[model samples]
Target chain A: MYQTNQLADATINKSESAVDVQPDLNQYLMAVASHQDKAAFAKLFAFFAPKIKAFGLKQFRQEALAMDLVQETMSLVWRKAQLYSPEKGKASTWVFTIMRNYSFDMLRKIQHNKEDNLSDDLWPLYEEAEPEPDYEDDHLMREQLIQGLEALPPKQKEVVEAIYLKEMTHQELAEHLGVPLGTIKSRLRLGLEKLKEKMELHND
Target chain B: MIKHHPESTMIHAFVAGELPASLSIAVSAHLELCPHCKAIADKATKAMADEFSGNEALVELAEPTPAQPVDEFATMLAAITEQPTDAPALKSAAVESSNQMALGEKTYTLPRALRQFSQTKWSGLGNIQRARLGLDEGDVHASLLQIDADSAIPHHTHKGYELTLLLDGCFEDESGRYEKGDFIILNGEHHHSPYTAEGCLCYTVSNAPLHFTSGVSKLLNPIGRFLY
Candidate 1:
């Protein structure tokens, strides 16, 4: 169960065509983590370029800002690849983190210019893992994670989905749910804590 | 351990990037060794990742579009290498404040730094040794009151108002348990038979000394007046 989810960090879309050129996801990550592997780099670029662009477009609300964020996020991946721990998170989450950080930078920039602090209420800043210069495994420990999430109660699932997927902070989720900030946090904590208990057994 | 506080909204500050860096790293190290925290983190992170992926459709259908690449961002990859590790910086001498060690709690700290007058002044009271810290602050007048955690201060109420933020362990009165980071607000209407559980340390700020409702203990009110 754990081995399967391990591959999650790779950009290999379970639905998309499998990336064939590499020995495995981990190996591929380590090999091209440095700027030297242009072939691997090109492959990665093809995978993330559009995702980054789309990611930025959502946040900046302008084509140019989105492109800049995309470019910056990818470039950051290029440098930090060595720091990416295959054990920490999936590839998509990592890249998402970079874009998220870029968004935060934009928020700070907005604040510096005396603009409204919209990001002020946003919590849960997810970070991207850098490209790993060394990944020894091809498998991922994700099945446990997936199964755990599937087991959550509907309301808990909804809360998790809204806050995490929608990028709404706890405060934002609270406003949307018409609940107290404490209630939102309690839901998040309780939901995740239950999932964690189930996952620990599966991972073990 | 299930911390059953009615208000124990313990979000992984680590996940939120809001925790101090060293603490976050410490938690990460623990995650690698203890599947407990890791699985917890994994569930949160994976759920979050899935949520974001699903939202891709909604975002694509909207908007005037984002800006193009800027020179600062273009150089981001290179910049990541030069940036320092996201580790929290721990100063050499972190515990210099007037926080005193309560006897029964085994150990308690004076807050780190800001107490520069050689040593704290410990005055003896019944069954407990009290310490006076001249460390003053805004609305809350700061002082270090160390009582044997096992011993209870005689019943007392405030003349003004008082605020206490717990720093070490739990302290319980008629109100409830106060763990670390617990900020307790008490006014003249409040009276507590406060005692530390297994002994604890509390950083207290009071605008005035406490006034006893009824007791020969009311005699302390005169001194509490000058102290407050």
Candidate 2:
């Protein structure tokens, strides 16, 4: 479970699909933005909608709400695609940010509709800044990062994924994993440091 | 220059949209003031996006739902493609108003992100003046605090965590001098009295009440409950 260098090599050698799809994803987003390309939109919808639905299900624990999140997120992506630029970030990053924002909005709306005493003025004030380009070709960087994650010690990987992907609080994650809170923090810190080092080394 | 900033972990949570709404707003305000943190946030966001898009297994698991009707897809496609109108003008108006927050004789130009919430009435608490921002519906409390020049807050420590964003003037505590746009976070381990030479205004959020730690101010611990 703790194998590091070997696992990194193995995962990188095996997972070629991860490296292949990102440029095409970027192109699809650009086509949708430049022209109202229905074919491009359909392709994006086919790829991202289900994954977004899975995300919503994990967060909300309700199938109907998850489906709604998928629809709302995809619709926003369509309307806002023109704002996307490869110079700023990858298409997936842009879409993921939109989905995350939409999820919060939907949650807030539900909470507001349920309680009369709560203030109705609950909208967040800040708009998301455009993503900064960290790598000239983000797809290659992503492939390396995925390989890095695969290389992490299992415990560290679990903690990193829970915090970054599942949105769990440190305390909650500790409880969920039945580990000491300090252990969770250390694991997360170490995992992130290693991942950052790997990405930086790859870029250099 | 900003002497303080939210930690990288906090910024990661903010970019991932994992923070609660009140904390998110406070971090957002800080982002507008601190370019250093904003650049870090952008990088974190890009990395998360790359990781998300690279997950071929997750994408593959989501086989196209056969149940989604063709007409529904068509309707959604049409809705998304509709041309937006006059949005830029409306956005500029909003941005223009957010720059000025009026209280008494002074008008503070706030960051654009904080301009949307309408201000509530400020209530005087000794030398400190405070107004609650009704921007979130939860247990986490957020407010604007104004301390008069040459005044000091009683020494205190937080029960959970307190995040304060300095919006105007400067204040000093045992930790260091905090100027406009400094983002400070204090936890249970910290105990300091904050003082200002020039009266300061700040946006603050706390998960729990602050516990007053010194002198006659201990009597006002109950009042500190309402202040946070």
lDDT of 2 by residue, A1-204 (tens): 112334235335535644445545656676676665666676677678767878889888998899888887888677666666554455687788778877777776776442221111122222233323223243675668779999999989988877875455676566446689999999999999999998888888
Tell me, by DockQ, which candidate is best: 2
Clashing pairs in 2: B99-B109
lDDT of each: 0.50, 0.71
What candidate 1 gets wrong by more than 4 Å, as runs, is: A1-27, A60-65, A105-204, B1-38, B51-167, B173-228
In candidate 2, stretches whose alpha carbon ends up further than 4 angstroms from where it belongs are: A1-18, A111-204, B55-97, B135-138
Residue range B49-96, candidate 2, lDDT tens digits: 766666562122233356955554445555655645223233234224
Candidate 1 displacement at residue A101 in angstroms? 3.9
What is candidate 2's DockQ?
A: 0.12
| Model 1: share of real contacts kept | 0.05
- lDDT tens string, model 1, A46-153? 455666677667656888888777666767666556555444444556656666655655644543342322221122222232112221133245556656777898
